[model samples]
Target: MERKLAAILAADIAGYSALMEVDEAGTFQRVRAGHQELLEPEIQKHNGRIFKLMGDGLLAEFGSVVDAVECAAALQRGMAERNAIGSESNPLQIRIGINFGEVIVEGEDRYGEGVNIAARLQALADPGGICVSGKVGKEVGSKLAFAFEPMGDQRLKNITEPIACYRVNFDRGSPDRVEPHLRNGYPTHKKTSIAVLPFSNMSGDPEQEYFSDGITEDIITDLSKISNLHVVARNTTFTYKGRPVKVQQVAQELGVTFLLEGSVRKVGARVRVTGQLVDGRDGSHLWAERYDRELTDIFAIQDEIAHAIIEQLKVRLLPDEKVAISATPTEDVEAYTYYLRGRQFLHMCSKSYMLLARRMFAKASEIDPDYARAHAGIALCDSVLHSWRYADVSIETILATSAKALELDPDLADAHAARGLGLQYGGQREQAAAEFKLALALDPDLHEANYFFARFFFEEGDFERAAELFEKATQVRSDDYRSAVLLTCVYLALGRRADMKRAGLLGLERAERELTLHPENSSPAQLGALALAYLGERDRAKEWAARTLAIDPDDLNAMYNIACAYLHMGEHEPALDLLEKVIPIASVHRFWWSTDPDLDPIRNHPRYKRLVERTTLASP
Candidate 1:
């Protein structure tokens, strides 16, 4: 083997397998045409040669880093133009990664860390985009017209050291167009970012876990108020709960500059909170503090932590941001405690948990009638319970509680989101849209706002809008599987077969991760079954379906979701049987029954038509 320094360019068709599954012969022909008509000519024109082809991907070597970078940009631009006019249902897009490093050349092919880094960077690139290591970025800097967006330090799989990466932006001259560089639809933050991991429960009681979790979430929320700082959402950060993690590893995975982790202990009438902020780049402590105070000073402790972080980071807090950060939700510590427990239950995402969460929120409201966040929590639980057909909560009650929340704190994003959900369920689409818009305007990163808004669009059969919002929801809360799973339906409806398959794969991956943490939580299994069936894992899908059913034989939401999975797996009779039981109880979101893409396989069947008609007649 001859060792040489070369610019390695790796390119692959995104979701090639899914495209082939939809139309085998047509996909093959498209790939061949792309290589012959576009790829080969572009590489040769830029003084490069394709050394190896790996099914849907190819590895090419260029003499200069400039030629490699320029060739990648041109090839991607060409693919975009061709796909713009293509008649195929699935658009053909390629992701490229370029690295300038040493390679071991054997015979006619290249092998080494250089080629490996290029391949991994290709996987990190967005479909129809390019990613390059810092070496390539620096070597080709200002030598080309293309702009580069830094993606932070990424720890690629099996690589010893972290790599600085950048995404190649092709539309630098076109201000009106937005060609986003995404990794599985998750947006990259190019700002000062931090993730606050779940605080350790040092109270030595399992029941006190909620207190620590709540403290972590509140600190995250408080930090998020600063417009200059990008705070990772609770859903994504809490995934690290109870796990032994390395500071640099967590930062690399989360793509953040800093990590905040600590412990919370509450013993009788006293509370001790210890927090430390670490610079993820070098795992150096930027700040550390411990607060020992009365239980009633919990809010003060949270405020001090938030202020310490702000001061350490030198983030300029606006007047409104400071007020928002230090503001206490409730004066009564007991009410706050109950509200935190309610939030913990709400995150469980089950019928029983929803009921328990609602009761806890109700108790909090009863204790402090003017507590806006508590009332907002009640509205959310009621909306979810009523929508899932789990409880007999009236729409009037949802509207009243949400309205009371808004009356108390109109600027609260959760209150507006809860109000919007209530209005959407009450058949007031315009008002709901307004509420959703206002909620998002107040807090663009709020998961509930994005999730509820996406549901509104999905029910209206606006697949394009729904997909965009669902993708945003998944990005805001990286650990959420529901939005990713729902994107499978929206993408399928829009005839984005490759996107649909990618979403299903991502949803299943996240669901599997959730199962590792909460093995008995059947919601993940229920959703995972649908994603599995979409990916053509029939037996595994059936296994997951059986597990979900065994966990809750009479759960309406589980039965409905599993029925969708059954349809995907070609079990029409069983799907129809489950739908027969679910349709009658689906008092809310009747439109989901009428327009679900999963039911299209059996839509024309006599039994399916009858079930739809029965639900239509039963609808008020």
Candidate 2:
């Protein structure tokens, strides 16, 4: 007998006895088909070995808890897909349970408390669902994309002590609505969907563009609070900024039923806002409104637009929803103005822009000491600065600022997201996961929450879920080249060749579009190089890499990313050269370097090994 720490996976067919009694031969054959086609293959794919098999159940052992949990999800998903097309009245459903603990192994058989806990958990699972021990859940809390509903402490049938458990929400395997590729210029999800286009800056002063953008975002936020509506995220709609796009075309691209077009003009104390909602199906105006009022009435104007759209659509808003829609982030318009200005630079991906954004946010907070969103903005700026290696930001500072934001406005989704990012950076995985979940629950279309959560999964090497989150982020923020490019890398790692190509091409297209809009920005080129390299356009990738370096030779993030692109393109020497230059100053990202699959090709190289050694010595 040998005792070892192993991840145990136990699975059994639901209602097996009933199915067998109905049609013994058919049930057996279907079960065999499931084992042959789904179970065995997925287990092997995830590096798990089936140690034992019964008539309607099996037990497997994996070296990693991650692999075991992933295998359980795959098993349940495969069964769901199979059952979807099955004509049988009694389709086979699998209930899976996974646990990580010490197991007593005896010649191809695993036993002990681990196995017992897993079996008990499998019985606790609903048909076609997975249940995992608290240990497994904690280990995978932030790593995987699956939502875990806590089951509290459970008393196992034969176990001495109770163990905590969680039910994995693997039902979110794919989009429940119309698939992206199959969408054809219509809202098919039985929800009233709309896209709010960026309001035109009719004020004549280009410096006032931020004000118009802020008005547009506020209206979008107001409408989004209505549970009956499906609002396209701000980032996705902003991609059409300054572009002459037809309403129907925009609807087709965004898969929305309605489009909101607007313009804002502000001169000193007076402000005018005009908005119209059009039926995307036929390009007919459903509602139109214009409000010319004092600048202090700007918030009222936004609420009016939201109410008009809801009334036109006949959406029933609950009391809470009504309050949410009408609520303002700040009473002070000056603070609000400064906050909007800060938001203008939030996604610029440059240190100078981030610094300026931070200053703007700080000014807003100074003006209104209780402006929760401004504090959230400042926290996010610090998070990004630290993440991008642009500045040294203490984890304590990030946590404190985000905490302040949450304390000021407990329900603010942005505050939750900011806190989540800081908690993730501080290595409080469970707390971070809860904050992210809360943020998404409050505002499902939040780009920052989806993007940051996707980054967490990507860093954890959970490529499948990371890809899903990235896909969601891309849908929300179509102009976000970073998420698009990272999606390509994730698909590449998952061996989804076609998806990789599609994502890589899409990333390059978005990056080029961004470059056309902002020619001086080098971040697009930095990411575009990776997309090009993954797509096998070696020369173009190298050119883009050189372009990034030319734009800013001192940009460590660009240098590191280009090094990855070079490694992917099989240009080892230049990749090594860049790594040598970047490793010392970029020591903060050593964890990323260790985990990024892009560096796998040269991970074992002597020079790369030496660079890893150098990183340890350079760490603060």
Candidate 3:
């Protein structure tokens, strides 16, 4: 035990679980052989010490940051070369993270934040790649042949300061690889299609954005009720909220026949709302209107606009759809305001945001006891937080709140969607399906209904239906990160590798963008990592996977994704082992064990078969 400043190198096998499942004894021997013959020698060559073994990882110390960085790169290259001839049963890959700082030594043990930082960074490394803190990167920057990608300031758990990280670009010297095309050949509708961009807030106050956004969302929701008219989802159109784009460009980007542009100016008790429906083909205004109304008649104004759009688009809606469109969300303006604020927080989807949303919804409920949409908002927030492991709310709470919403307004689609999720997770599959179908029937444009129903199809092993619905969800909301990621999973299960990669890349892009704004949420990072693996960007994949693990080590959904990452990398044994870790926590995940195309390569393995059986027996 002693204390001194030093450089620490942390390394661990990538997909170790999947590798072991492919050939436990052989994989163990291979790792052991590499350690004894390759790893040990390489460390000694750089004058480093392998002082500790933590599970399937190694912790080493070097006097110089230069030595540690060099040793890490060489070890990575050597492992990649060794894996060149490796088979499915025995592929060898490792991720390394390095940091330079003072270490505390006690007897033969070394411990400190420096070591912790190195280990965390190691998790960020891709198979056959290295990650280092800013200090290590600066010290070795001028010397290494590899280029480093600055990963921005990563907020690591238990670390006081955000660490500036760099990922060693493993593909820098590798042969060129072609990336597949991302666009699907989706046909344009012969009928009317429209995208309603978020209404501009001319309220002159930026804080009034929520009101403008609420109007835009309600219009989109109402328009979506028209079965024959194709409408882009609110999430997709909101991406253009403040952007000044031409009508033609908006139409082309959304692939719609028309564009709905508008502005809302709320001044005191009176409000001014203006809207125009522009023909996509010629960028000509087909219809235009302005509504000057008191705050109490906001619902009437919304209904009038929705009706005018339908008339101009020349789409005939059935009695039910028409009724759905005109259904008032809330009669109380104050309650509606609270609901809008709650919605703003709900979409942020983090623990803190969810708490804020809960408060807002509670206020709305207190203000108007019969506000079904407000109650539904509360239920939806709690359910999502629970599902994402962002909160400890019970299924009972979700069920109770959703039921109260339905009791207040039976046809409220969001309430039904929330109830469906509650029932689905509560093991009432058939009842859940019924609820989802009813929800969609009430509001076909409801994002959650489409997403959750598509998920049902996916788990039912109906990949074709799942893909269709997931694609529908994306069509409804192009910026829907969850839909994009789940669609990637569906594509993988269909053995459509190109589609899988394309969907994954798009999902990862959107997820990363959202993560910048909501870094505390782990689902985006966890899901983004799986998407990266699908797209074969191993370096970034490892980085995101490590980030997710760092946020919440016991996040079963995230841990389940690590299993998918191993499979995407083609490490069968280690992928299975990762599943073993996930099964105890989320046994229902085993539903896809035999059917998931991602795990098809290892389904024949005896270990996988037994593990699936174990999980199945433990699940119920």
Candidate 4:
């Protein structure tokens, strides 16, 4: 004997006794035919096994609770449509119950209290409706597009405890219909919220994990182009990777109303993918599909899945979204895989990793020169190298690469984002803002574009707009440490003391943990120092600032922090001396010193005014 957790679906024909009394032979014949022609086939198609059938009822087992509930709803809907056409006396209807629990399996049949409870629940269900146990509702809620109205706790005859029950409602047109679109337990009618979880790697080879991960990211990028959806970025969704997650939990954590989960398996030249669209409010399956295709046609599979999900969710795909879904980077599967691998490496965020990423992108482009994403990757790599001063690549080379990427695919959001950053650093402020706006228009959920746009606004002294963009960026990538830290600065600038304190604490915690992990990196230490300075903790701020300069003496931001701390402490001589050191470096790098509100206190000082004039004239 073995025991396993499964979703138990129990259903029976409503008013079967009365119908049988009216016409025994005719009623039995119709009931049997309906089960065979409609209900049985749907159950089997949804991967449910009929364990037993007693007169006008059925007991089935399903691997997924969501599938079980969805199958039951489909069966009930079908029966409703059939009843609408028949005479009132012969009207057909079904009552369904679903529960998730462990059951004893002896041979082909399952037995236990779980099975009995499901049967009792079916009796409680209204005709053409479903009743689910509390446990089942919890697991499937947030993954399915159905409403669950609480029926309160009921005292079952043989059960010791009162069983909590919920009634499944699929009638979206009714006022009592509970909206299934909810994020973090709040109902939202807006179509702009979505979460794409990491796709399961069903590929036999463990090394091919990057391929599956890359495909998930590509789909996310395509969907984010819709602009109306608040798509959570990869960083936030990837946090649930390899973890046991319920659809509702994912929705809550990512602040998204819908969830997309899928698995990819590759066998030689052929690939298979299975995907499901789930309502994150009540754990209901909206749509599910399986695709089998040659490796060369893998892109088609992704497009088909996206289209199916959008249609099932009743989302009107914008013209841009449709175009984005249909767009193919390359026909060669190998080149696409390389491009995906490059993206994975780039996420590691290191100089060496970026160089390797560049090589892979170059290889992908060589295999297919018209692969827009690969070209964009190349442009981004070059731009990062120039920004970080990690390579001796000339500005002309960086600009030329970005231009080529844009020329190949003018609508490529990543290329636009990279070009924007390049332009901003090149002193073309208006051009940079335009490029950033274009990138956001192309992909509203592109976290980097939103973040850099906020940075651009903040640098241009538009604090209000910068704060709004920063908030949007945080929604896109909630766990982004830099964004959290930047929010602290924004709150401080706006004089929102409570928000400033909260943000400062968060930034300090993240920076301290990051520094603990990578003791050699000065970036987190510098950020921590700035956070401390903002919090008015002068001594701790000075300590971290000293540590930052000790690690990287040329770190201009750290030097600025030191000068600011002295200015705040009213140590004018020391502050003037530190500013003298930073002014020359700021001049060389064209850093925006005047726009920084941190230095406002000393702005009117003759020494500071002179230093600003000297730095601006020399740099300009």
C-alpha lDDT of residue 249 in model 3: 61
Per-residue lDDT for 101-120 in model 1, tens only?
Answer: 99998999999999999997
Model 4 stretches with alpha carbons more than 4 Å out: 1-195, 200-213, 222-244, 248-258, 262-326, 331-368, 377-396, 513-520, 538-543, 546-585, 588-611
Give me the runs in candidate 3 sitting further than 4 Å from their true place.
1-195, 201-210, 220-243, 248-260, 264-327, 344-360, 382-397, 550-556, 570-585, 592-620
Q: After superposition, how far is residue 349 of candidate 3 from its true place, in Å?
A: 4.5
User: For this target, which candidate reaches the highest lDDT against the unseen true structure?
Assistant: 1
Backbone clash count, each prediction separately: 0, 0, 18, 16
Q: How do the predictions measure up, each by TM-score?
A: 0.68, 0.66, 0.56, 0.54
As a whole number from 0 to 100, the lDDT of residue 286 in candidate 2 is 87
What overall lDDT, based on C-alpha atoms, would model 3 receive against the true structure?
0.76
RMSD of 2: 15.4
Ranking by TM-score: 1, 2, 3, 4
Q: Candidate 3: minimum summed lDDT over ten consecutive residues — where?
A: 177-186
Q: Which candidate model has the greater TM-score, 1 or 2?
A: 1
How would you encode candidate 3's per-residue C-alpha lDDT over 3-93 as one tens digit per residue? 7988999999876765666688988888898898778899999999999985578999999887887788789888877888676445788
Model 3, position 102, has a per-residue lDDT of 84
Model 2 stretches with alpha carbons more than 4 Å out: 1-195, 204-210, 227-259, 267-270, 278-287, 310-322, 584-604, 616-620
> Predicted candidate 4: what Cα RMSD to the true structure?
20.3
* Stretches of model 1 off by over 4 angstroms after superposition: 1-195, 203-209, 226-259, 267-270, 279-282, 310-322, 586-601
